[model samples]
Target: MAQTADDAKYLWQKKLDNGHIRIGFNDVAHQEIGEISFAKFPDNLTEVKLGDVILSIEGAKAVSEVHTPVAGKVAKVNVALKDHPEYLESSDEDKNWVVELF
Candidate 1:
């Protein structure tokens, strides 16, 4: 499916000042799954291959894996969900960046 302004299929990829690219799922991902409850990222420093399982999210009904479009080192993880997992509901991408690669 093509990514439209109303639908977010392709993640918004941006290069950070550090040279690593930051990526987050688009709104379509949230809309398809409904209110996301759980977001799981691969362990830090773990190598993730393209199309590999980067993160699996549990929505209202189904569980889906968020794929990694690129290959790199997992530099950081968003721990905000530990307290407010629902953040993924309000702000799907910015607050829900599953992991950052280095």
Candidate 2:
């Protein structure tokens, strides 16, 4: 079944820009994980040595870890998303990226 924007929880896509990869969890993650209550991460902009636990998100049901898909420097974390966790559950692709690497 095709998921219309309204029917989907989140979406993610890759971009080729200076070796940076953006990752976001779609509405499905939000719906499955429930409200996000907490987040854990290494020290700011810590070098992620490939396949490391970069961060973790705590939802109402469980805490999930966000891994470093590839070895790179953690460029930016979406503080906005951290403040407004519900956005993770309802945003379209245009507004749903959780992290960016450089």
Q: Write model 2 residue lDDT over 17-94, tens digit each, in one string.
A: 667777677667777778877655556655776556655667786666666556666677766666766556666654
Which regions of candidate 1 are displaced past 4 Å? 1-10
1-102, model 1: which lDDT tens digit per residue? 211222136356668889877767666666677776776665653677766666667777557766778788777766776566566666546785666777
Candidate 1: 10-residue stretch with minimal lDDT = 1-10
Q: Give the TM-score of candidate 1.
A: 0.75
* Cα-based lDDT at residue 48, candidate 1: 70
Give per-candidate clash totals. Answer: 0, 4
Evaluated at residue 60, the lDDT of candidate 1 is 79
What lDDT does candidate 2 reach at residue 94?
Answer: 42
lDDT of 1: 0.64
The CA lDDT of each predicted structure is 0.64, 0.61
User: Using Cα atoms with residue i matched to residue i, what is each candidate's TM-score against the true structure?
Assistant: 0.75, 0.67
Highest lDDT among the candidates is held by which one? 1
TM-score of 2: 0.67
